[model samples]
Target: MTVNQQILLDNRPTGEAVESNFKLVQSPLPTLEDGQVLVRHHFLSLDPYMRGRMNESKSYAVPQPLGEVMLGGTVGEVVESRHPKYQAGDKVVGMGGWQEYSAVDANVPGALRKVDTTHVPLSYYLGAVGMPGVTAWYGLVKIINPKAGETVVISAATGAVGSAFVALAKARGCRVVGIAGGPEKCSYAVSELGFDACIDYREHTDVKTMAKALKDACPDGIDGYFENVGGYIFDAVLLRTNAFARIALCGMIAGYDGQPMPLANPALILVNRLKLEGFIVSEHMEVWADALTELGTLVATGKLRPRESISQGIASAPAAFLGLLKGKNFGKQLVKLI
Candidate 1:
């Protein structure tokens, strides 16, 4: 029997998460039943949404149960399989959580899918060519619906989802402006990611100041906004949005710390005649195939360049996740479990 190392949620955080909240333990894997496969995880995705799952309050998905495996997306190889569809050495992506190995039921819908790593890296399945990529596609194509030559602004611009949006919007002929935490990220957004301009949010003292910077950066006014950080960033964007502007609300990392960070200007939404919609990507599974196809092609062809900030092992996941919450990660955050 193979020993499976697992990270369990030891306790829910009241405010910010710490390493103490997670407990790593090891257990022997059970014999596989028919229609089951044993997977040895190679990479684990650490996303901002995982913070919400730690809360005990009601959320879009169920609160992750205490003492269970810390929920996450993982890519791995099948070591043993009783299922006819899967064979040993097959690489697959699934919700394998924060563990070294998982015994997954092959019959479950959307539980696992084979991945081709010959062209694209296996880690891309957790970020650019995977869930985050599809998320950016859904928000951009379905909600924002940006037309050619329009101005698009995105926050957390160098992050997993936001980086994908930059590429997607730029490809559609939109002039993109990015709002990031520092000079390095802002520089990357403009220099490496093909953004028209980028504003360093840390350079401003308040929303009013940031709004002025956004106004100057977007002289044509903002036509479409992709919101990731919600507090002051949302307020600044509200001040510069053009009439009939659309905002795709992807995430509010600013409010994840249990702080009261409300939007400062609801009246702007009315005055600007903006259409703002918040979304959860997992609920829309129909578009995954198309999104992945396009995203995969972009990455493989070097059109879409998604970056990663990877930590070494499962034990490092908690600190890495906390660092991500603190805006320390440069791009998509992942744990290299193998």
Candidate 2:
């Protein structure tokens, strides 16, 4: 019998999740049935959406029930396989939850993607060449509809999705400015990530001041906005957007922690002719291969860079996840399994 370690939900988080909300436990693996593959996980993605699942409220997606393994995306190697499609030594990516080992049906719905990691790092498949990058691609291209020489602004600009937007927008000849939480991330966005300019929202005292800074960066009104942290940042960007501007509503990291919602900006929508569209990435998964192929090429050529904020062990996943919610991660956040 093989023992696998997994993080179980000890309790639902009230506001910010503490370490006590999760517990690591070991369990014996069951005999694998036909068409099943035993996977040993290597890396697990820690995303902002996981926080929503920790709650029991009705959401766009169903919440994970109490006492079940916490949900996550992972890259794993097929160590033991009764399935003909998978053999030993095949690397795969899937929605594998938080565990050192798991049994997955070979035909499990949305379960796996065979990976060839010889060129790009294996971890990159879970990040820039994977979901977050595709999310940015569809959000910016299909929803935001950025034009050449337009001014495009993105919040949480140094994060996985935001950084990807910076690269894609730049490729389209649009000027890009990033909004981040600190001087370091601001610098990272501009200097390292090749953004035209960056604003440190934490340095600004008020939304109006942030609006002024963003305006100063653009010198013209914003044409496209890829929204991630959408409270004060949304208000700030609203004040600066040009007529007929489109906003891709990617995430509202600002509202994820149960904070009081910021007042809406209906006046700007009326005056500026702004179009805000909310999107769920799963809606575009059918066309994911084309998006991933383009993103992977960019990563392979170094035109796109993915910063990984990796926690060393599965035991640290709770703390790492909390850090991501708090904007401590520099880029794509993940837990590296030993």
**Top lDDT model:** 1
TM-score of each: 0.98, 0.97
lDDT of 2 by residue, 128-183 (tens): 88888899899888988888999999988888898788888888999999888899
lDDT of 1 by residue, 47-98 (tens): 9999989999887889999999998999999999999999999999999999
User: What lDDT score is found at residue 257 in candidate 1?
Assistant: 72
TM-score result, candidate 1:
0.98
Model 1 pairs whose backbones collide: none
Clashes found in each candidate (C-alpha, N, C closer than 3 A): 0, 0
